[model samples]
Target: MSDKPNLEEVTSFDKSKLKKTETQEKNPLPSKETIEQEKQAGSS
Candidate 1:
């Protein structure tokens, strides 16, 4: 056997691949009446 140890190959990690794609669209908040209905529905 050779005196030198066998080495494993290492893969280069790309930072761009790790980054998450952000959604451009923003969801609007619920209306006042909708909020009241939600609360009433949950309580009943």
Candidate 2:
């Protein structure tokens, strides 16, 4: 009984961690060049 709950918790945590990693990989943050271009456009 105790082992079952522990295993379920571990599996759920791992799935969440993997999902976060995949999301980050799919949608990366903007780069420095992109930021600079945005600033330049805004100033103009």
Candidate 3:
């Protein structure tokens, strides 16, 4: 079968029932202090 739905399916979909989720940061970047410490340790 094709990946895309038929025109009838698209037209019959309930858009109002869809939900919205909050934006989240799963893997945040290291802070400036942490980065600087890593650099100093590597140079030593």
Candidate 4:
């Protein structure tokens, strides 16, 4: 039998920290132009 841990059995992982870190590494919010365009599209 292989010694590697079973990936399918792990269901308690908290990914919020990882996601937050990744978002922080990149821009947390969209740019002003993009936000404006989205708003305009939504209004239309």
Clashing pairs in 4: none
Model 4 bad stretches (over 4 Å): 1-27
Compared with the true structure, model 2 gives a TM-score of: 0.42
Residue-wise C-alpha lDDT for candidate 4, range 1-44, written one tens digit per residue: 79988777457776674644333445578899999999999999
Candidate 1 residues 1-44, lDDT tens each? 99976554324546676768887758888999999999999999
Weakest ten-residue segment in model 4 by summed lDDT = 17-26
Put down candidate 3 lDDT per residue, 1-44, tens digits, no spaces. Answer: 99976799788999889898899999999999999999999999
The local lDDT score (0 to 100) that residue 35 gets in candidate 1 is: 100
- Give the lDDT of residue 37 in candidate 3: 100
- Runs of candidate 2 with Cα error greater than 4 angstroms are 1-24
How many pairs of residues collide in each model?
Answer: 0, 0, 0, 0
TM-score against truth, every candidate? 0.41, 0.42, 0.44, 0.38
Candidate 3 stretches with Cα past 4 Å from truth are 1-24
Runs of candidate 1 exceeding 4 Å displacement: 1-25
Q: Write the per-residue lDDT of candidate 2 for residues 1-44, one digit (tens) a residue.
A: 45445565665675544544333476889999999999999999
Best by TM-score: 3
